[model samples]
Target: MVKKQDQVTHNAKPTAVESRGGKSTIAIKGTFPEKYFAKKATMTITPAIKNYNGEIKQLTPIDFQGEKADGKGQIINYKEGSGFNSVQNIPYDPAFGKSILVLNSTVKKGEKEIKLNEKEIGEVNMSTKRQDIDPKLVYKNQTSDGTNYYFSEHNYIPNNLVVKTATIFFDFNSDKLNWNLPFNQKEENKQALSELFPFLMDYDSIQSIDIEGWASPEGELRRNQQLSNNRSLVGKKWFEKELESYLKKQSKETKSFMKRLTYKLYDKGEDWDGFINALKNANIEDKDKIINVIQSQATKIQKEQQIQNMIAIYDEIDQKILPCLRRSYFKISCVENLRTDEEIMRLVNISPDSLTKNELLYAASLTNDMEMKKKIFSKAIELHPEDYRGYNDLACIKVAEGKTDEAKKLFENANVLKSNNDVVLNNLGIMSYQDKDYGKSEKYFNESQKAGMDQSKNLALVKDTIYTIDYQTKPDIEETANDDKTKKQKSEDD
Candidate 1:
């Protein structure tokens, strides 16, 4: 009976060992059981791959013979057994993604021979090629040892700036909606409002709509003060009515989530500052004097009085400037889960520019396709170059794909865009851990834990994970499975 091979290689634990220069190898080394071979028997051993498709491909075979056997090959001492080492690599093949390494052997003496059952040695899985890199990232930076290692976990969710804003003006002292007002009719305002309704319809995504009403400083103090308050109410009422009407036309399913729309109103009374700003920019008569008069006035009444004086005196300030100051500004900020994954994916592909940096990052999570995520992150980097997420994220992809050189560049770029960012720093730390650079790994992990993005790197990560044999072990642990090392250890002992 053949003794089970002692697997010393940790390559069995998966970190996605990428093939280099078109070469892929599976090596085997183990001790033959003491006296397992017959005194005059000779044996031949061959290793093979039983692939996912149920096909077997045989590799080169090596021969061993007992001391008394008529063979001129590696001799097996029948009393002590023996340790053998063999490494066989082939050109990389995608079909080898999910396969089994098995041993095939024949024991022969004289004209009689016996073929043994193929025994599974280990599994070969290349599925990690689809890894998002950081979902398992390779820290791109290199230490004193070498530039190889991977680190990443799918823990962080990017925070997005979901709020969008627009301003629509009202006539001074009026609380009514002004359809024809130029500020209300501005194309940009229309564009802003255009997106507002869809969010309101999906009301769940809409966090809140805040409308702030303002009045230019003029007329009776109390009246002008109350004007903004009334304007806010008027705008609120209009949205309530508009949304109600819109919901009335929706199906019950669509209407179910539209039960209520949250509206917060604010009265930012007396745009005296706005009036002053208008005064400075105005080329009308007594611009400087008007500014002086308004600034000199201590009380709101006096300021209102000066504004009235100016209104009565300068039609340019009264008709043109005051109208701009008296307006309602509204903002609709969305919640974190604003868009559906499908919508985000569509936007990522069709109009990535339309997405915020956070949306782009989150969109990468919408699909399992690595290339799609790379596309999304690339767009984020292009549109929001100042942001670190894009660089850190794309670099992670690079690392997972065994493109450490590219990963290094991107992570370095991320470090530059935002120094000591927890997510990026922690990734660097994990890379260090992978490379057994414990000190550097801890420093980075601690910096990340105490730094931003609310991440905490576990210093005991490798030790803790190394115990699992999780379809794999830590890279350090995985090294134990190396055939060459196992073979060398025996050779050294002998």
Candidate 2:
């Protein structure tokens, strides 16, 4: 009996398709009817790419043949195995929208050859959807160094001078500034007083003078309170006398030019806080017990009694700690010589090295022109190579100019200078995402967030890209099932 054409069937489907580095490999599994064996049977599979422009390109084909049966009229069954398979690698282009895997099978019996089946096994999306560059990521503003001082409507340029502080030790239980005492006779004390004289005489106006008087915690609370107040008053009087003497020595024009100075006095009675702070650094025994007693004591009298009972510790405290507590702490705040904007602009162009790192950074912020900003940042990095802000800001300029590779290198250098910098990490993530490395980009974005970067927008972009790539690579179960049903019906009709 002759078998009907409808009794023989062929099936072809792609097992998997893997894509990377602008290339893809498609693996196909083909099946022939168990009872349909011929002397010579051949299967050919071809891969093709359809680009967005509707252009189609054919790739190399894969061919496989079945072995002939032993004798004429001998029925050999084709077993289910990997013998009917085809593997082809095709060049993947980002511009291409889809990759098509085509399958064809033919059978040769006696002197006649007949086609069996021809179908498309599967198709995968080759196009990649890239997200738009985030504006925030492309134009990161440089961070401030927090050294710029603002006064009134003008920016105060630091003269490289720090706030000056002076301490004056007093005699035991005494509040007066004992000028004749040996402690006060030290050269440091003389220099401190002399420095105060010139500061008042030279500056047109002093910002403020804070006099904080502290007394040892061993005495009665009320006595200690009065003693601290008296010490602050006496310290203020000494400064007043010194200023008067200095002004008397100054010319009349100098006195006329000086502005009225402001002063504040604070009586910090019983320097208990300072005492505890000192004990933390002290190497004396029973330090923990002392600290515990001090913290646990509810009243000043209780604390004083507890400390007095520790007589063995008192000698050390008296010699090492108490002397330092019986003193007045004073700080003088003064206005620094400031530069005008005109002068800063001129100096930035002429002598950028003269400006502080903060000044150079601030100068960059002052201008809207990209070229000027770049020049200012160049000078800033030249002068302060150790500071990562200069490199970070320069990288932002590179990004805005579409020099992404250069920006990436700059960000890497910045990260080397300041490891785990939020801005540098975020920019690196952006570069990775643009390169279609979604996993690497996600890793970088997460790290940037851990480093304190505000990466919500960039993270969302990465997630969207990942979803797009995943959907493109893996077929949906429902869609694949429907496709199988359609192919089966078509095969049966044929």
Candidate 3:
């Protein structure tokens, strides 16, 4: 908006606002008319903008002194006025759309002062604010875009190898695993055992099963050794029986997991460490003396007698302490059954419902085709409507299509599903930016960054609008904006 009044002539009348040198600027260039200045007169020129809400933003004023006037100001000649070029950068605000720019001038000579009529520079055009940043998406592995921008994605399952451990306990002086005993009756043991079949049936490939059995040092060393070995053998046999039963129930098409399974059995006889730890932890009568007698005694028979004597003195050692020493442990190593890229792509279109949510999202990520991504995301939302990932990712697709209205609705839906989510908050920020609501967009980006998604780049982009001037200043230029700055700004973007 650079058109000048009848009294003023401008270098150029820019129709649109532009971003240059990473700053949003509105530059005006012109010169005062010759013989316009009085010998003892001082003039003040002010530029301002009237926004959509009728609020005015006044820029820093420029001053000029007459030849007879004192002070360090641009001395205007009485015969020939000075040239000027001003570049005033202001952050982009929502209300800046269709704003008007005006110049105010005043002159003071002797005891008299005159206020000139307001000059319309022109309507400031905000067309340069329109930009497509191509916002990064959600639900995937977050990556950097060379400029420290976090590009969020959803296909985060890099590897599915897992080592799961489950524990089962036994009864006092028993080689058998008693299901009714409180130790053995824990739901975790049953849950852990039950989980193995399904993983073996389809989900994962069972690599190895490590089983360990331990017995308390209450019996003879040789007897405890045999007991530990028998208990571990029982655990292996029971697991194999459970696998066989599951195999009978499943379809023959499923792979035979037993053939793939490798068993490593360890019989840890006489848990002396367990006994000492239990004794140290227990709050019992003569606790110190009992531990000393057990740990320092010479013979196993003597230690057993001392333990028996302590058991008589305190039932805590026999009931609560000893039960924990006898136990069976298992470690199951498994690798997830991952489908190939070709398989996922074929199944995504043919029978999408059969694919899992992660597989569908991964399928969408595999292709550069937007239409394919749209189809995959559509199915993801359809099959898993409750998941926010599908909604957010589908909205990103709509945004890429320039379907802002549709994208906004989907983004809102994602917010509803997972309130204050970082990825959704960032997308919402972009929506606000598109709607010309920079203030609201800033708040959302700040929240997004705080919530773990980095939106700093977006924040700076929204706040700083760059402006550049390719044309030279006009003959009417009265003042340059940055007189102290000798070097001109040339942006890489220009």
Q: Candidate 3, overall lDDT?
A: 0.72
Local accuracy of candidate 1 as per-residue lDDT tens digits, 312-403? 87899877888887877778877655566677778877888887666677677666787987887788788988877788888877776878
| Candidate 2: residue 421 Cα off by (Å) | 3.0
Clashes of each: 14, 0, 25
Query: What global local distance difference test value does model 2 have?
Result: 0.65
- Candidate 1 lDDT at 412 equals 78
Across residues 1-494, which tens digit of lDDT does each residue of candidate 2 receive?
02433443333333333333445455544444654444355434444555446567776665545456323322334453233445555564565545444444344545656664445445556444545554542333344321111111113354534367777888778987677665577899778867876665555446788898889898889999998998888888887776777777774444443336667999999998888888878877878888898789898899988767764556867666776788887788776556666778899999998876777776776678889988987787788899887887888788779888887787778879988766667767767876778788888788878988677767777765311221132235448778999999999999
CA deviation > 4 Å runs, candidate 3: 1-132, 136-139, 142-159, 162-165, 216-227, 241-261, 269-322, 415-421, 439-452, 459-494
lDDT of each: 0.67, 0.65, 0.72
TM-score winner between candidates 2 and 3? 3
lDDT (Cα, tens digit) per residue for candidate 3, span 378-479:
888889999888888888888878898998898889889988788788888878887878888889889888889767688887876544322223222324
| Candidate structures ordered by lDDT, highest first | 3, 1, 2
Span of ten consecutive residues with least summed lDDT in model 2: 145-154
TM-score of each: 0.41, 0.51, 0.64
Worst 10 residues of 3 by lDDT: 469-478
